[model samples]
Target: MSGATSTGDVLTINGTGLFVDDRGPKDAPTLLFVHGGPGQGSYDFMHAQGDRLAERLRVVGVDQRGVLRSDPLPSGAPLNVQVLLEDFEALRQALDVDSWTILGHSAGGGYAIRYAHQHPASVRAAIYDCPCWDSDGTDRYRLPIAADLLERYGELEAARRCRELAAKPERLDPDDQSWGAMRALGKRYNELFFHQPDNTDALDRIGSQSGLTEDQWRRGVSHLPLLTEMYESKQHLLPELSQPSLLVHGRHDLVVPPDDVQAFRDSVPNGRVHTFERSGHFAYIEEPDEYAAVVTDFVVSAHR
Candidate 1:
């Protein structure tokens, strides 16, 4: 399992083309990254941490089907957890890797879990970074924490605004711009996941440098149907997963609270939770060095 020196071009799998950015030694243990976002691509992960992780392990970041640089599905492509899992299996076979560890972030973590469960023999281990395993838990816990953080920051008006928006069902419709508005308001609150308020600057820098085009963002958001189906069909499968798992979470993550990670820990017999006390949702970004170390240590120790 060796890595390509440069980012590889798009490869088609299951009639859909996806972008893969590969790095690290070709012979090292391969770690495939499944980026968060029902539509977010792999660009940010590559830009921020790919090289660092590559020093020890072969790192490959994938833009899942329908994400940035990946072929978009038809307006109403029939997508579900099964479809996504099949796409991953196709990618694995296409890449010709005997097995690879999986690192899934946010929503991508859900995909990683499913893949590991369905094809446990193909996965060496699973690393979930600030994962969103259950949408109901996310909706239930996120807002109150966001409001509290806002009030602490003296943004009472913003706090009130988020509280009002939180009362409604989370909108997945691309045309309904309220979800965008809610996200804009919640951005600062998400930054609070860092122990230091100033660490939010890192997020801004990563966003600007990552080259994630507006079109890609729109495409990612448009896959609301996939998200809805995931919520409805996948919640029950968490407890049945028995693969080796490492659950990393931020103590203050409003987007996917620690409680959800705890539930994940409770379900998976081989699972263990590691909380970044000073971090929130994006622990990898907020605590990059420690994040890499934790991931490296876990993958090496588990595989050994």
Candidate 2:
């Protein structure tokens, strides 16, 4: 693990009510990291990765609308996908970088793909680390990951409910207690999928980023129910991205799965895939050396 050396500024995207953590050097080629969570920001997790990535390239980490340090919570806005994509374009202009690359993980992957599709000219290259490609696609793709959940909890009823929710996308009532339990179980399952040594801390931070207290977080768990909807709708926009791309996924990734990775490889006109052998969903953390190498190699190859 590398010790974090910090030098960054927090700025707002004008009129959009969102914030971004700009790291690394101004002169360095900008590599913007679009975090997942239509609402979750890229503060801690992005910073953890940025601490390493910034050393090689300027890492721009953004907290999407509604997440930490960003304004206009999804609760306060219309919470549609188009609004978010526009916010991203606005962000790039506000930052004033002529051309840049973007890397997205998990939900961020979905965002990254959409952004690249709409703004291909501005992107130097794009990387999708287990992007949630389509809403229906994710349902099929996540079955195995969900199996890991059922295996851990052995709650047939809960598993059935989860499967139903994932199968049929819908906005859950954020105030429902059962929905909170469902979300907590999902988070636990995601950690198990990653198999990281210190998953508890990362999971805790992720759970905390909702800008809500423990009770509120659990109580409002269904607020992000749209995740399933957004994820399933992930694929149709793939053809729009013409930028050179890399899709890094763990063969054993229980969350996004290798099958989904393969689908991406086949869909993108200019895309490549790097499979991590023993790692799971969070390959960057599980296989840090390999993850860094893959990203560095792709970035270097593109620049050449």
Candidate that scores best on lDDT: 1
Alpha-carbon runs more than 4 Å astray in model 2: 1-8, 72-75, 144-152, 162-187, 197-201, 205-232
lDDT of 1 by residue, 115-145 (tens): 8889988898889887767655565466555
RMSD of each: 3.9, 5.4
Q: Quick one: best TM-score, which candidate? A: 1
* Candidate 2 structure quality by residue, lDDT tens digits, 1-304: 1112243344555454555666667777678787654454566545356666766777787666655545445444565556667777777887888778888877778878877887878888999886766544554455535645775777676667656655555533323233333454654655545655575356466555545354433322322755644644666666667889988877766446556666676788898888888767677667777777677667756655
lDDT of 2 at 72: 40
**Reference-based lDDT, each prediction:** 0.73, 0.64
Cα misplacement distance, residue 249 of candidate 2 (Å): 1.4
Question: Considering only N, C-alpha and C atoms within 3 Å, which residue pairs clash in candidate 1?
Answer: 1-26, 2-26, 2-27, 3-26, 39-220, 193-280
Q: Residue 18 of model 1: what lDDT?
A: 76
